[model samples]
Target chain A: MAPPSEEPTDGAVSPADYRTLCDLLRERTGLSFTEAKRYYVQRRLAERVEATRMPSVRDYLNLLRFQASGAEMQLLVNLMTVNETYFFREKYQLDCLVNGMLDEVVRHRRPGERVRLWSAGCATGEEPYSIAITLLERWPRVDEFQIELYASDIDSMALDRAREGVYGERSLQALPAELVERYFRPVAPGSWRIIDELRESVDFSLVNIVDPAQVRRFTGIDVVFCRNLLIYFDDLGRRNAAAMFHEALSPGGFVALGHSESMSRMSSLFVPRRFPDAILYQKPAEGAGA
Target chain B: MGLVKAGSKGTLGTAPTGAAAPEDWTALLEHADAGHRRHAAQALGDRPDAAATLAARLPREPDPAVREALLTALVRIGSPEAAAGLAPMLASEDAGLRNGALESLQQMPVDAVEPQMDALAGSDDSDLRIFAVLLAARLGPAERSARLHQALERDPHVNVGLTAAEAVAELGDPAALPALEAFAARFPDDPCVAYTVDAARRRFRGAS
Candidate 1:
């Protein structure tokens, strides 16, 4: 076997290799690398090329095509996705979710009806746990209603961190003191582990949002927190994801996006509703029909 | 014309190697399986001649994944016809498609995409104009300054003007200073527009 080159022949992916990897990455996951990220992707994946002992990016791509077992494919997915998230990263949006979204849903909910919420791209579990904390604290009778909270990410490693529910102090910066005290127990120096019941309330899974079939499994969800996820997708990916969110939501359910994202630009399926503190999308309530 | 058949081991290389007739690859787009269509679509990017053929097939393309592949091919074709076909997609209801088309157009050579600009900038639609101004800012300093100037002065849409001001701030064009001042003066109380204009002025002035 040819020894792995200390450096890529050109220290970059060839144009063809870039295209091939991009196509596969976009297909397997909704995540896309912008032109600016192309060079970054090349440098990041160079180690994989070395570890796999491929001669060039082309060779590595060829392996992905003809010979990759699921492990190699998963490795590529893990390398390309950006999973930077923290507890309460965007507190204003969470505020909207707790104060406005849940408030409206609770008022309209039928007796014993569980309020279902999904945190798509819930990297490292910060988002979902944050949601659970927000619900538990804000909803006066939250325990009285059955609550189904699902959190998913394409990165299995991140999901593992999320599953463990242990977080460093950095993830707690935006979290209010009261919520932290109430919801977590000290685990180590400057670290906290979520209380067991709070952690158990959320169901975490590996989900690629671009896969229509996988997304189809979720239906009648009352709220979806898919913030900061769609910004990376290309237009086609964004459109498809929006359609999927539309399909997954129950009538009159809400979808909250990152501050910079807007569903109006992509699809008419959701109506833009401005809350006192934030803007969100709501699937239209069903009409009186069969 | 070059062609790539995704995953054909016999033809596999850094790029899809092995010269197949262009017709053969284009023909594969008609196949029922999404994977085949995706492969063919990715392979045909270098064929500007295929733009019209690909654009025609876009609407009926049921699968979003296949549609994405087709859009990528058109953007790569970078022909005038391809740019024209791509314009409508910038306004697609899907944020992904809108962003994809916008990014693809931004990446295309200025000369190649210039043909589609007039229709976008001159249109009555504010969204398209906003998109056009954002795109123009990426076309290098001179062109960006020029478009930003006209957008601030002449674009009827306030949102478009506001977007232009933001792009000006991002580019920090010294030449745009006068326009930025005028724009800020035009909307003194409109905090959103004023913020971008003031920011651009500060950026350009600081650079000077």
Candidate 2:
């Protein structure tokens, strides 16, 4: 093996090393990195060189490709994945979820049949908690109807944060003042602790959305908020994720996308349905009303 | 990447001198010489609707000095259109262009920041992505945490990653701890990397 260059262009990852790393990242996670992201990839993997005690990027690539166990690869995934989220993000969509989508699900389900809302890519629990807050606020009689809120993200650390249910003031900005007052108690200055009631409502898990077997585990979901997620996925991953959502949702169940995202280019499994100011895709129902 | 450089000049030395009509300024903006275009850009600064024309010319402007002047004009115009125009400069290889764009973006209204930063944050250019992370850090805590986290995770540039590690030090988001630790581990010999990671670890752990 060639000896590592002591002076590797002052933080520049060698081109060959970068390509090897990109291939591994793409194969493992379906993340597409461009030349623009080359520096970022090099930097993220550089961290691994020290943590894993690998001699160089080349050795680290070798370990990731041929030697390291699942735990080690998982550590790399943890380092490289993006997890940006906050409570009540994109309120217009939340408004549609509570006022329109859930109402439709409520009307169709048999008595005592619960509604399950799955927040895919629910970074740090904000999206799932936002769903719970919406249900509690808009559907005060939330108990009357069975409700199960399942939130999953590939990032384990984010899942832990979701479980803790503590948020800084910045997270609460988009949230209505009254909702903040009612649903959260100030745990520290500028930080609000989500009440147990809201915390307990969400079932947080570490599940990769693109994994068919993993996504298959989520079944009969009434609504899936996979917002801001597919944007990170390449075409194959996005299509697979779409197919998984289609299979996971019961007929007539809805899926919401981030404002900048769209299903028009990816799938035909769900039809776009417009709400007051937002749009959600809905699976077609099988049987007509008697 | 090609870099552009030019001698810096002070802002339009004197008040506009009631220079020609908006239409004349618009035409002069395309004049062959850099000075004529610079003055035209300065003259159009007060006309909000002229933003589109100004924004359109920025990316193609060959002169760094005029580009800087146009950037200043955009800042003075201070419209969403102007802010949108500045986004292309963030991806420029020229340090002056990027800095000028960032300087104007910093002064933009809160609502204008996201649209300007959004394209760059998602840009295929590493330079823009790095600037996006830095810009996000300056926006607010929420934006800082969000953009820096994304930059730390997905950016391929070492400088961008290192910059992100340092920026996240202020937010103290524990989610950054693993990445920071990884960074420290990767560049154990680099004191700057170690210090950044250690400080971030302390802050994030303390926050938790």
Candidate 3:
């Protein structure tokens, strides 16, 4: 066998090396880079270096370039991505969902029209589960309604965990005692899992929010919860995502964003509406606000 | 007291009569096994304080699920004390705990939560910082508005900056209008910037 590839000596790994790594990551994963991310990359790759038994950073970089498989690529993506979320996160927005948006949807939905919701960037599944639980709580005969909940995240690991629907004591804390006891089952020491009833209500998939074509496939959705996540992107990314959400929603459907997110700068495609405590956007009643 | 005794029947332990017997309603919350905690928790709606007490006792419970239950109760209760109880957990080392605390705090009224708002605004964690900015927007007193201005100037996260800018605009402090205009100028291409600017302009026009 040929001699092993040369690895960069300790002192030789410089800012230039890091820049190359950043470029490669951006090229492959579409993650934007700012000065702040340098440290995160260094720290994450440092751990990977030790785990791979690579003698140096240069060798690791080469392996990543030439030998990385789909799984390895996914691992790299997951490591770099952050999935920070909680149940009923941004309650004001959920309030809009249960008290305002859902009520309106139920009222206008033609008899037998299946109401569907998509929670984009759902992060370990809290948003969608929250939606399902809210419906269950609000509608005494929820089974009589045709409701489909679709939850998607870019991270497969998060999707897998979300599918499990098992949360720790902390994840359940904000939940009302009744919902918790009713919806979850204790699995291990200090681990409570969402029951099949709630879990079954959601369909989890791995999806990138930046992918417009894939997003367009989801049409006629009654409501979309894409909260807090749009802040991560650059202007182009945000605009793309916003336009996609606009297209995905049925006319008169609502989109709830993170408190900080707004559509005013991106497009006139949505008409903003203010509820008691939250802001929502509606694809103006057919032929109206556009 | 009599209600407590009557409520305690069929519970794990017999309630001592006339001694403020454990609320029988409390027994309605006990699951046969930890496996049923979610169901029991859900059944205890409108009684979050009592449910919180029970949730705090489940040592063998899964930490995330139990925390979720406890947090649910706290938010539903919407009591000042419940909000206070969750304040410190915002700094928890466990991400889940910190997140749960932040979520619960978000549900509270801004006036009732002004005291703890500063700590969150000053947090190193981005989630806490963002939540604090939003919460601060709901608070009164010129000081809260001033603090939001400072946060807009100093926060490292762009999103935090945007939230602070929006909050300042909401306060309708004419003093904030120029700054909001300048901030909006920076993100000329940001869709959110237009909303922020429009809010500030509306406030400025209303004040005039």
Candidate 4:
């Protein structure tokens, strides 16, 4: 039977209803939305609207607001907060790593010691793989050190994809042709699977950044690239994660945050070290305090 | 060795199992390693009963990391007592500790923070009073307006009054027009206050 069309017949969410939704979303998550972002908001809301089989966005709003279980709210948040991660996303930090940071990192390392790099929220393999390829391709002495790369995400499904290490054009658009040819093999039209060597190079795991126990697994990491993820957290959540990162890092390790994020708000555990291209935070060398 | 595959050990370590008792965690709050002590604070934060212990350790905590862990734990607990514990840091002479406390308090919900507002408003320091108004404004609209109006009406410092006036104006309360006009009279010669009050008048009347 056809459903009754009692609501706004076109399934449009009124402006006031949209504002209420944005306000509720802002309260629950720290993310902000405005009229300029209505298209983005509505597109995601439409997916949930259809998935729930709700007649219109207004009723979907009721499901989001009044539902005691808050399950659908979580589903909406997951969708809304899904960042479109791509390879070499923000490469200046990578440049900083290759040119100067790597030299400084190896300065204190003993011969045959492993240097660990962690991708705290590596969604779909782009970030960690980018780092690996940059080291192999850019750093002149890349082969001299035994580098261990670790990538993790709270979402298991994302980790699964990262382990599979396959990508489409969206993820590969930033890679240089030679690097792409050297690293990836064509799986299909417009699809490439990272060569088995690179796939196995990064160890993908599921980790919730805020959970101390979960975050404690990797100690003595030399570099942590946690781009764009911490910005979603509230102040306390950010601080909690920062403290965890600080504890997990080795004495003189470095943290690279998203371009928009500053160490100032996160924690005072690390001192800001400015590289030629980007700013990074360095945990003090031993015998010093932040 | 080149980029090694998941080591002889598995890719990731086993999930962390077992939690320490609140007492165990609390005892370790004074651990020598800042990392150990920070973890203790994080563990106690999960215990709603440990708010006072976490709060008590906050002022004496010299390490910024440990102080952060303590403040985060209190924020996680979010009890009224936790709010009260964090409130005194508003009066701290140390900018880092005081600012950390303010940021942490801002993360708390209104109910958790409501009881402490009076103490903050009555603080001898005017900066604390201004911070109290800002904290009140972070509350839900109904409470935010009420507390901000209270500050506008009763605060002695011109700076506090001005901040309250601006915050109330932002709330766009219809009744705040007369309140703003009265506030302008209190600082008869101060152009900044006069300008702010005038601006708030237009906003309130326009909003109404």
Q: Which candidate leads in lDDT? A: 4
The TM-score obtained by model 2 is 0.55
Per-model interface RMSD values are 18.8, 29.2, 22.3, 2.3
| Candidate 2 lDDT, A1-290, residue by residue in tens | 65566327576688777777776775566566767787777778778888888766777778888864556677787777777677878888888876667778878556556677788889888888888877767764466666777888877777888889999977888888888989899998899989887787677777877554466467778889988888876554565577667767878888999999998655544688998958998877755210
| Model 2 CA lDDT for position B4 | 9
Q: What are the per-residue Cα lDDT tens digits for candidate 3 across B86-159? A: 77676667665666566556655565577777677778887678778777766676767666776766666768
How much DockQ does model 4 earn? Answer: 0.41
- RMSD in angstroms, all models? 11.0, 23.6, 24.6, 5.9
Model 1 has how many clashing residue pairs?
10
Model 3, span A78-164: residue lDDT tens: 787788776777877766676667767778555444677889888888888888877777644355556777888778898999988
Task: Report the number of clashing residue pairs per model.
Answer: 10, 14, 51, 0
Candidate 2 on B1-208: residue-level lDDT in tens? 0000100112112223455767898899889986578668756866888877887888778765456456656765667788887877776776656676776677566567777777877777777777777778777667667677766666666677788998888766677776666666666677777777777888887888
The candidates, ranked best first by lDDT, are 4, 1, 2, 3
Candidate 4 lDDT by residue in tens digits, B43-159 = 898788999999999988988778888988898888898999999888888888888888888888779998998888888989999999989888887777777777776677899
> In model 4, which runs have C-alpha deviations exceeding 4 angstroms?
A1-83, B6-19, B165-184, B188-208
Per-model DockQ: 0.05, 0.01, 0.01, 0.41
In model 3, which regions exceed 4 Å deviation?
A1-14, A17-30, A52-69, A139-144, B1-208
DockQ of 2: 0.01
Candidate number achieving the greatest DockQ relative to the actual structure: 4
Tens digit of lDDT per residue, candidate 1, span A218-284?
A: 7777899999999988765676687667667787889999999999765555789999879999887
Task: Tell me how far the alpha carbon of residue A46 in candidate 4 is from the true structure, in angstroms, after superposition.
Answer: 12
Candidate 1 clash pair list:
A235-B96, A235-B97, A235-B100, A236-B96, A236-B97, A238-B96, A266-B93, A266-B94, A266-B95, A267-B93
| DockQ-based class of model 3 | incorrect
